[model samples]
Target: MAELYELSMLLGDLEEQLVTCMRCGMCQAVCPLYAETGRETDVARGKIVLLEHLSRELLKEPEAVKQRLENCLLCGSCAAACPSGVKVLDLFLKARAIINGYLGLPPAKKAVFRQIMTRPALFNRLISIASRFQGVFTRPAGEILGASCARFESALLQDRHFMPLARIPWHAKMPETDEPAGPDKTKVAFYPGCLVDKVFPDVAKSSFKALRHHGVKIYMPANQACCGIPALSSGDRKAFMQMVRCNLELFADKDFQYLLTPCATCTATIKEIWPMMGQYFPPEEQEKITALAAKTMDITQFIADKYVLQRKYDDSVDKGGVKVTYHDPCHLKKSLNVHVQPRTLIRVNPAYTFVEMDEADRCCGMGGSFGLQHYDLSKKVGNRKRQNIYQSGAEVVSTACPACMLQLIDLLSQSHAGIRVKHAVQIYAQGLG
Candidate 1:
């Protein structure tokens, strides 16, 4: 009872944003989870109502409210579709921190987020060791996608086709560099978010290849921290801030025109979420964060905006090339409005014919930890995306986010779809050859 009072008090801080939701039901039209379950509690308006009730002490079941909140994908669909222009994602994230502050996090999450993730070196070492022994417990599930499944039935693995960690992480291959820009070239810092570093090192390689092809200088720093979205979404503000501070320190002195990342999620987190959550930091720290966020750009966005010539080409021009479709990650499309840049990158590649997939901007259902906690719901949402990809009749599917690549690969591979998955940068880089 006392804890509930304290939680409500904490939630009181968001009362202004909470009341912004007019319950217009605009969120329903775009919510992927609500579309699957048709449950009121799964939608933004429903969740907002619950938070309001909890804040007012009109609700008694904190556990039930917490469960309903955790069931969300945090894909920003509701916030994007809101006619009221409510800051739905910001309100929900802050409410989550308030609720979890009173309820407390699970032991496992505490150890992982606070202990392992906050320390980049330890986290990298652990993932490296796990990569070496992963072959023992997992077997190849999809040949073309390079996905794996558990050798024996396991609760965690559970017949899911997942991309395995790279044998050698990207940083190990190119630990750090301070390459100078060529004549009339721009210098940019490269950030390979956790997934890109550990699971899809090729994306990092392709990003480098593409940047070099354009005569852009590179300045990759050592010991880059996780973007902290995982920790923040899990309601661990402490861990999230730790990561932000670590990254701020690393890039504080580096001289670069822009900060670029191959991962859409990382780009959004740095450019949007970092500034949104910067209120917790000191004034000087907030200024640094704001500056960094301003300079952060998605790799595809950087290439398309600065280099690619925007001109419409007839589909017949590239008819002989492999047909490729783009999937707009929720973070890239909804949060950052980056839907067009990645497509531009794909369209510029003469070796690939770009096809428009139905609902290309829809969420691929990998909401960071959301998929891990709600695999059944996640798969239900992802199956829809897979169906759209199949209908496109494309030989390859490309996206800007590595996490989306993970989800798309799983969905397409599990259904035995022959379509290959590649990052837009990868497709663009291949064309440079």
Candidate 2:
């Protein structure tokens, strides 16, 4: 077991950063978890106070503090809304790392993060095999939503409607590629995050279509590792850093003008969190992170900014455009300030009508593994998003993040809302005719 003194050393680095919090209660208005629980301890302000106390030895139970820290959705809502510009997510993440270091990770999470997640090839192979048998345990819950629930009685999957893994994952489809720049003379290294690679390969295919349509060259290396967000968010810094180094080793020497992904979480992780967490690394690794972060872009942002400029926005709604509503993924909109570009892609398609849902920017509550840890709370947050979607009265709903897409599909499927969920890239790619 790790010692408190060790945790203090780790958390000492966060004290100066934590002192910047003003406790103005602005975070309360935006924090999804706080809104649901109505507990001060659930919000950033409360967490900051607790961190301050723990750091000074005022709080005896580091376990209690650890629980509070893990309760967060990490959706960047409070951080986005903070008036004093508090690095709330950064602080919480570092603090979680401190607490988790001392307290240790749960056995299950330790196995997943350390054994399965860090080993990319083994992880993919296992998931590929597991994907074949998942259908045996789960029966279709919603055809339109593409979701499944446990076939029989089971405590683990009680009533969850989840998107099964793709029968053929993205990597299996296009194992590797190194296409030179097309007429546009632009090359990109594509990073399909885990969810997109194993669960939503269509998004990857769509991204490839959009890229090829615009004459962007592709450098998609096979057996790409996880984005390290899962390990980082789980407070497994060792695993997180290992995964990061794995990716850097793969992508560092690649010649590409941009690193792109359809997954909003992947985009935000690479763009914002990578640079933010690079401080503890060596100078060379830090420089590599900075360079990579500079070139990373969400696929939608890349398309709207670079490709759409060359062509006119299609205004051909006369073709009886499909009524589609957009869900602003918290990672894309709040973390990276990428709000308009996704909608712009929908509008440019001319095959879809972009409808704005109520509280479109609110979190879908699929904080990667958060949903698995606290299903009831996750469902409560997700239900709010479902209500907003149903109220929008759109036939189809789209979001940029695969995780958000998973949550929406689950919520809508369980509610029997009969709405189709899709990634924004899939919608745009289908319209690329």
Candidate 3:
């Protein structure tokens, strides 16, 4: 045995941050997984207890600790509701890194995230090939959600109603852009994260159209890497750092006042995780990373703050016209304290009556890898969200995170549920006549 790597060095830094958790148990009230499982380990309080144990060396089993850590949605609900202000995100992210560091990456994910994801060109090429071959191997399971099931019992496909990769990724289609920021306007560098670039290219296009409609100067550089959420969440700090370094170099000295991203997960990771992990870097690099983090903002928040919407409110409902519900992504709402802005942006479109779903801010159980690692639990949690969406009786369920859209589609599609998953901006952009 090479001997499992020790986590003490990193755990030392997290001690003070973990202490702030206070074991308040308030997180239970809001955590979606906890709501479903009723397990302390599934909630923030339980996760905190595990961390305290891990830090104190009460638990020697890194795998056990890692499993508990992975049980979370990383939705930031507990952090949002925490009174003592525990940096749950910092703790969980670092904890995940600690455990992943010990066990090493799984062979399959290592092949994909490490060999493939780290290299954008190869990653894009591989997914493109998979997209073309998908039809031969997969069959439609649900037409309502445009979801497909495994054509055969392939070990890779599992039970996923995966959103097939688009024929042309955004980067392939839009290699780069430089269409003048027009007049004296602060140019924004928009970073549409991987899913938006690949799986939901139209969402990225709509975001681009909406930005242009607002007359904001935009500069989207090509070859942008993953924002490192997947790597970081896996505890492969090396891969995460690779992604960060790649992104930093990509947007080097663009003279843009803001870094805007349509993806909620990307926005939160840039705003919160970038500055956080920067502490380990040398002073000069740290300063630059800190500055970059400061400039990043969610597109919805940026639009709400920077542009004034010319509202077209029709107070009358024309026979149940357009019922849409907004689901708050944890990163956008909890991590960023930005729940109302997207809703406000939604309301700008008077044609649709925006009805808030029950536990609108609840985790949709996507949690990036949480869905992959614990698919059974993911669906168990997602089923609740599906019921909530059905309960809301809204024609559309809009959220900022594309990952959530994927999960919602899987759940809604399988149940033969009549609901549509969408981005709030997509709804708003549709109203931009």
Best by lDDT: 1
Clashing pairs in 3: 97-235
lDDT per residue as tens, model 1, 46-145: 8888877774433477677778888888999998989999988888788888767767899999999999999999999999999999999999997999
Q: Against the hidden reference, what TM-scores do the models get?
A: 0.96, 0.95, 0.93
lDDT of all predictions: 0.89, 0.87, 0.81
Q: Give the lowest summed-lDDT range of ten residues in model 1.
A: 53-62
Q: Which residue pairs come into collision in candidate 1?
A: none
Better candidate number, 2 or 3, judged by lDDT: 2
Show where candidate 1 strays beyond 4 Å. Answer: 1-10, 56-59, 316-318
lDDT of model 1 at position 149? 90
Native-vs-model 2 lDDT? Answer: 0.87
Between prediction 1 and prediction 2, which has the larger TM-score?
1
> For model 1, what is the error of residue 432's alpha carbon versus the real structure, in angstroms, after optimal superposition?
0.5
TM-score of 2: 0.95
